[model samples]
Target: MVLLKNYISLRDQAEIVRICHILGVGPGGLQRPGYSTGHKLQLHRTCFGRNWNQETKCQERYNRDGSIPPLVPPELVSLIVTSVQDARSHVNSHDELPLMSPDTALVNFYTATGRLGLHQDRDESPYSIRRGLPVVSFSIGDTSEFLFGHSRDEDKLKNVLLESGDILIFGGRSRLIFHGVRTIFPNSAPPSLLQKLKLKPGRLNLTFRQF
Candidate 1:
């Protein structure tokens, strides 16, 4: 079963598939970072596209050129902004996700035997720029161990199981909360999603921001 409703959850398999497919269309599009024990710390500080200069805990950009599509997509920006219009209906509602206005979505992928460590997404300016705004994150594919911490300190973290089709939104007091993926249960995916991703052990994370 899934846990960690505040930051992650199991979502609609079909819609998750569609989003994953569409994510690759961008030039410096989404990424499937080869996971390693360092993945969590590495990605937490990694920067993508054109925003590296600003990240406090930066990581290598997914693209070879270290460039990415804009933090905010011009054409689909509006649609993405409105994507969470009904967010309030969900567990982590819109009213709490203030950054929903300038929604920027970043896709990160993890493959077999991959694991991510505990960390926080405090690099994006939105977390501080738009006060009290929460970042909306979506997870699909194989299950993984998720951790949430009150701060960067080791003693404050809590672990949870994150399954396919999960949606996580952290805002308000939880906005700056520390979180990250620990380990991916490789080869444990549902056959259909595995097929969608070519039957590999992996999970795609899409984070929405209001930039």
Candidate 2:
């Protein structure tokens, strides 16, 4: 069984570095592409499901309906599964997390001028497992402000800077906790990666999901 501990990466950096190198952020040497949301709110998630986490783990997030963009190709789904498996090997079973398998990848791209509010990956239809599922998130390009909270949206919150190659996993008991990205660290990313990309900010995130 995996143990629940705080910032497991701080104590196990070698393992973290190995995994980050193995699981580089952004698509596997692919260019970023643009897609249309049809200019509409497809609202695949609901507030009820969002509330469940609030009452339980106080989390509010779920699987997105969008698929990986075509222009900006990313690693194959199977490859991510493999990478997730490889990364899990570094987890501290007795002090960090238990076994988990991330199947779906919700790739998020942000620009230096963009901002994402605080939210949690809780109500995702596929991860609605009452006990909650682990969300394996990888951050690449530019450091950003990552916020975390305990229960209510307004509580003892913590802010952490998530730079390129940072992997954050939240699930199990922590799955429903409220969390979000506040701001981008402007120009904290590589010029080559940002200037060459079609997307803004040059930051891309791939979150592995079981759904």
Candidate 3:
């Protein structure tokens, strides 16, 4: 696992917010995700490059609404790649994660009440899974209480505060660890960001990975 604090500049973060707003207005954009049991998630989601079917653990070009999802922006792709490479330098050579050609981005916008139950990101191909390709995640806006552990036992889970402009990457031996968002801290976003983007009270998370 690797954590880079304030890695994204304010200017770049603003640009990303703009892009998200633009894409979120179209079909197959920012909508509540639900489980197979019909329980709606507290957060809204939109996909780029490829849409993910959570229940099936499959990737599709079209979304549930039968509309094509937007392509992942070039800037985002560049950011993801660069972040991973930089993270690689901070770890020991033996634990360095494999560089992946990420072609899918899952964007989630979470409110103060948002939370995600513990889960493992294992939907990628067997080869990708075997290589321990990293998931490059960017956090913007409000802070989140992130939980991670080898097992589902809440007592054993560790917590981390993911703030705006933070980047979290986990792969290699830690790729299959269970993780999730416990909650979002209210009024924790940078004031300038909220004013500039006219954003609501929430955090925007983008996870880049190869499928």
**Best candidate, lDDT-wise?**
3
TM-score each candidate. 0.65, 0.55, 0.95
Q: How do the candidates rank by lDDT, highest first?
A: 3, 1, 2
Best by TM-score: 3
Count clashing residue pairs in model 3: 0
Q: What's model 1's TM-score?
A: 0.65
lDDT of each: 0.54, 0.48, 0.88
lDDT of 3 by residue, 1-211 (tens): 9999999988889999999988888788788988789989888988887787777555665547777777779888888888888989888973558898878888899988998889999988898799999998899999999999999999999999999999999999889989999989999999998888888889999998887
C-alpha displacement of 7 in model 1, angstroms? 13
lDDT of candidate 2 vs native? 0.48
Ranking, TM-score, top scorer first: 3, 1, 2
User: Candidate 2, after superposition: displacement of residue 118 in Å?
Assistant: 2.3
Relative to the true structure, candidate 3 reaches a TM of 0.95
Q: 1-211 in candidate 1: lDDT tens per residue? A: 1123423222345555554555455545443343344333223222223333222233334433555444444533453344344454554544555545644456667765555665555665654545766576666677777788887676777877666755666666677677777788776666766665563357666666554
The runs of at least 3 residues in candidate 2 whose Cα sits more than 4 Å from the true structure, single-residue gaps closed, are 1-96, 125-128, 153-155, 191-200
